[model samples]
Target: MLIGIIAISFSSIFIKWSAAPVSVQGMYRLLFTSLLMLPFARPYTGAAAALRARDWLLLLFSGCMLALHFLLWMGSLSYTSVASSTMIMALEPVFIMLGAYIFYKEKTAAAAMLGMAVAIGGVVLIGWGDIGISPDNLKGDLLSIGGTAAVAVHLLVGQKLVIRMPSYLYSLIVFVAAAVVFAVYNLVMGISFFHYPSKEWGIFVLLAVVPTVFGHILFNWLLQYVSATTVSMNILGEPVGASILAFLLLGEQLKVLQWAGGLLVMLGLGVYLYTGRKKTAQSETALPSAS
Candidate 1:
């Protein structure tokens, strides 16, 4: 899981390094990943057929959400600092919590509510420090948030379907669907898919293998062993890892206020995870002893 976090942490950096358009970068990344998994995934064709109609629907929706996520997130890096873009991705859990409450009637504890408030406060601080009135930065921040929301939806929908298929197989299907979506999008936009330089193609392959294949699939596999809250908490490390890499590789630096804001975001996420887990543990412990 830690390795997964580190791999995904490099995602934004690779996107920053690529010169291709957002849709093009996304398209090739998914294309390569799906192609690589095609053989392994072939064996699962029978299993996929066993999936119910609702499961297939969720899978398609999850794929579409992920495609939109990459499109918005990769696009955001063009207009804002990597620190801001990565930090904003941390908002995914908050969205997930609210979504569970609305859709599943899952009750949130008071501590969880408080943590949400703190998390939002951290978001405001980060936005203030990062955007400060620049329309361009604001645009980037909003795009990142949009990406975060899409990812939350992807995860929420995926939780139901992951049980129906193996991790790699499910990932292959999602990536293939995402690739198709991005390909259609690129075609509609008249974007050239094969015109990127060799260097960009290498970066696309790295993006596909490292983050998409290794990183995300590891998380999917880990879901069987750990709670989703635990996974989400560990994912908070991505912003930290991405920030450090951006500093070392890209010579990017966060202002003091920006650092403070990022700290608050991480801190708030920590509180959120802690409170939510505590609530879950309590509920589980309170179950009837007859079980």
Candidate 2:
């Protein structure tokens, strides 16, 4: 989990470092990620044959959503501060919770609600420091919010599909579909897909393999050993990790209020997890006997 978090934390930095157009970078990242997974996932084999038509459709949609998430998120970096964008992106869990409850019929306990409220409060605090009403900043903020919502939908859809297929195979199909969409977008925009420098190319490959592939694999693996609520709580670490990296490598700084906001977000997530565990335990004990 720690490895996955650290790898994901670098995504914003890497995207910022890339010199290519946002669409091009988004497409290639998924393209490289899909290729890397192909050897291991082997979607061409019997595994691919086993997937239902509905699964295929869902995977395609999920891929498109993922691509949009990246495109919007990466583009936002051009118009807004990393702190604001990343902090807004950190609201993925909130959207996830909402989607899970609405679509999956997942119930939220009282503690979870309280935690969400606190986390949202924290987000407002962080935004208060760096947020501007200027047109560019507003556009960036809107894009970031949209990206976060897209990811929540991705995860919600992923959870459903993953139940019927291996995570690797599911990821492979989704990435391939995403790559196709991104390629089309690049072509329409007249962006050069194959003209990046070697250093940028290296970062692109690393981004795909390290975070998209390995990090996702590790996260799914942990699901076998830990609860989803616990996993969601751990994801709150991404913003903190990204903020630290931005400070050290990108020379980004946060005000005292922003730091406080980060802490509140973490605390809220902690409350959600702790309360979720208690609720799960209670439900298990309440189950009727088989007779």
Candidate 3:
């Protein structure tokens, strides 16, 4: 989980580092990730074939959501500060929690809810210190919100899908579908997928291998062990990581309010995780002992 978090922390940095079109970069990232998964996922082809038609449809739907998520979030980066965009997108957990409640009847602990509120407040401070509220940035901000909703849906569907399939097979299916979605989007936009320079291609590949493969793959694998809300909540720290990276690599400045907000975000995350652990331990203790 720690490694996955660190890998994903570099996602915005990589997106910022490249000059490629948003859809193209997203296309190759998922394209390469799907290709890499083929070797392992190929062995699970029989398992995939055994899946019901509805499951396949759900996987395709999740893939489309994932594609839109990358499209909107990466596109937003073109106009907004990384801190603003990433922090806004971090509201994904709230959306995920709401969706979980509506769709799956899942409920969260009071502590978790309080932690979410505190973390959201911190995000507001970070945004207050960073965003200018101009029309262009507002566009990016709205895009981020849309992206958050898209990803929340993806994660909600994935929580259902991953339980019945291994993470690798599920990811392979989703990535392939997402790759196709992006390919179509690129075609519609008249963007040439093969036109980028080698450096940009390298960045795209790095984006695939690092964040897409290692980061999200780990996330999918962990879904079997935790709730989707927990998985999404874990990502709230991403804004802080991305902001710090933006400061070092892109020369973005973090004002005083940003620093304070980052600290509060971390503190809230700590409380969330600690409370989660306590709950898990209590549930285990209440279970009948094995003979």
Top-TM-score structure, candidate number = 3
| Candidate 3 regions with alpha-carbon error over 4 angstroms | 289-291
lDDT (Cα, tens digit) per residue for candidate 3, span 67-148: 9999999999999999999899878888998999999999889998899888877877777777877999989999999999
Off by over 4 Å in 1: 112-128, 225-230, 261-288
On residues 143-246, what C-alpha lDDT tens digit does candidate 1 reach at each position?
Answer: 99999899888776666577667777778878888889999999998999787689998999999999887787787776555544445555666776787788
lDDT of 3: 0.89
Clashing pairs in 2: none
Please rank every candidate by TM-score, starting with the best. Answer: 3, 2, 1
Q: What TM-score do all the candidates reach, one by one?
A: 0.86, 0.90, 0.97
Against the true structure, candidate 2 has what lDDT?
0.77
Q: By lDDT, rank the candidates, best first.
A: 3, 1, 2
Writing each residue's lDDT as its tens digit, candidate 2 over 1-291 gives 778878887888887777788888778788888777677765446877988888888999988898888888888988887778877887777787777777878777777889978876776676577778999999999999898888777777777877777767777788888889999988888889788789888888878877776666666555544544456556666777777788788988878887888789778877876787788777778786532
The window of 10 residues in a row where model 2 has the poorest summed lDDT is: 221-230
RMSD in angstroms, candidate 2?
2.5
